[model samples]
Target: MSDRSQLDESGSSAGEAPAVPEWLRRARWVWLGAMLLGLLASVVQLADRETLVAEIRERSPELSQQEVDAATNSGILFTLLVSALTLMVVLLLTNRMLQGVNWARLVLTAWAGFEVFAMFITAIGLAVLGRGTIEQLAGQSVSAVELLAQVLVTALEIAAIVLMFRPEVNEYFRRMRPRLRRR
Candidate 1:
């Protein structure tokens, strides 16, 4: 049989599907867990409706009560929308990366880098201003559950990044590159 005839729709040889390496599989799960934890963190933050309203009011003192309520509701809606979109993007990128799409791995790496940078900036800001400033800004204290979730998500992302770039995973992607390009 001709080589072209032996290739499947996915560009793999014949009926064989690409096998995902353990490293990539573990990385995918860790990354997905981080996303779920982040969503949970958002839910925890939104649990305090009074605090949300108070924070909104404190930030915009000139806003009337009606305006404050509107802002609070809009903020909640916006957060939900953004969180949902973020989850979808993460799912797509992780799925593609697992399928040996090298570009997807790079995109995920960039996202992890961005998250690390953001966390660094936040840490420095918190340290410089101290805890009192955070309470003042938010008009309330941060919940332990939210803080725990954020920390766990950070750790999980770091783990995922490490796992995704392991030697075997890199080799797997390398082997798949030519096959994928032919399609």
Candidate 2:
């Protein structure tokens, strides 16, 4: 076919940008929701420091009150910094993904996979060590809000991943692929 004849209705030739599909837009919002939920969970977890101290004490009866207090303080600061950094990374990647960067989409998929894998490993370890059930974990180290947020985050991530790979989204990405190569 002639190059001009091959142009899409958008009046742009091949390798030119096309309008983003609706499914990709929905996927971006869904991914944003997951990131927000994760941020909320991290904040809630840090707020309940007494429970953190108690959990630490239960695991190590030998640690003095002073040591536990020190550890809790440091741990809270570390967790907060990590959470903020993670949030920044998520925002950057999501922006790139929406711009039709295929690598960004793959990175997000890998992230979700790693999160699910880590959760599975933690659950198995807890069960094998007879640590306690989800209810018990909530009562001890984790707050109800945090646990709920985590579950919702995981669900949303999975939903967003599915949406990202829809037929229309795939076509959009395919159209964008040539543009990427030229750059």
Candidate 3:
């Protein structure tokens, strides 16, 4: 077929010039996946903390009813709020960044890296600190499922970071970056 035949009605070639690099496309998915992963981690954290509070109550029956209820309800409420906020921010950032928003990319990168660090520490605590408390846990040692979830979440965050820093991916942001005002 002739080139003219491939042209759009406006006469521009159908093979348009705004070609997105494969790496950037992959990065978008990676970033989106990271946001989902972070949200998932937040959910799991909320649930685990709730379970911990329940276990605490079971282990300490003598604790005043008011005390147990107060702590348990407050902990869950705070965690839910935080988790919901985290989920919203992550999804928002991911969506904006993929759309070539420079500020959004920066925010997501910073947040994801910091979150990974936080998850790493939490994972270590679950894997090690729980071991110390195993006796108190009375055979309810932290299980493989919990450990794996932590590891998976950590790995997902790392993947997101790696994708963000990919040469083509970073270049996309560089191209979209706004000029800074001179001092």
- Residues 65-165 of candidate 1: C-alpha lDDT, one tens digit per residue: 99998988998889888988999999999999988899999998889888888777657767899767876775667666776777788888999999999
When 2 and 3 are scored with TM-score, the better candidate is 2
What would the per-residue lDDT of candidate 3 be over residues 78-163, giving only the tens digit for each residue?
A: 86787678667777777667666767767867776776787777656657866557535453345556556656766766676777
C-alpha lDDT of candidate 3 relative to the true structure: 0.63
Provide the lDDT at 126 for model 2: 62
Instruction: Please tell me which model should have the higher TM-score, number 1 or number 2.
Output: 1
Q: Spell out the clash pairs found in candidate 1.
A: none
Best-first order by lDDT:
1, 2, 3
CA error at residue 118 for candidate 3, angstroms: 4.4
User: Candidate 2 has what TM-score?
Assistant: 0.78
Residues 2-68, model 2: lDDT tens digits? 7755888556776458888898888888888888788778877878887889888887879999999
- Least lDDT summed over 10 consecutive residues: which range in candidate 3? 174-183
TM-score ranking of the models: 1, 2, 3
Q: Which scores greater on lDDT, model 2 or model 3?
A: 2
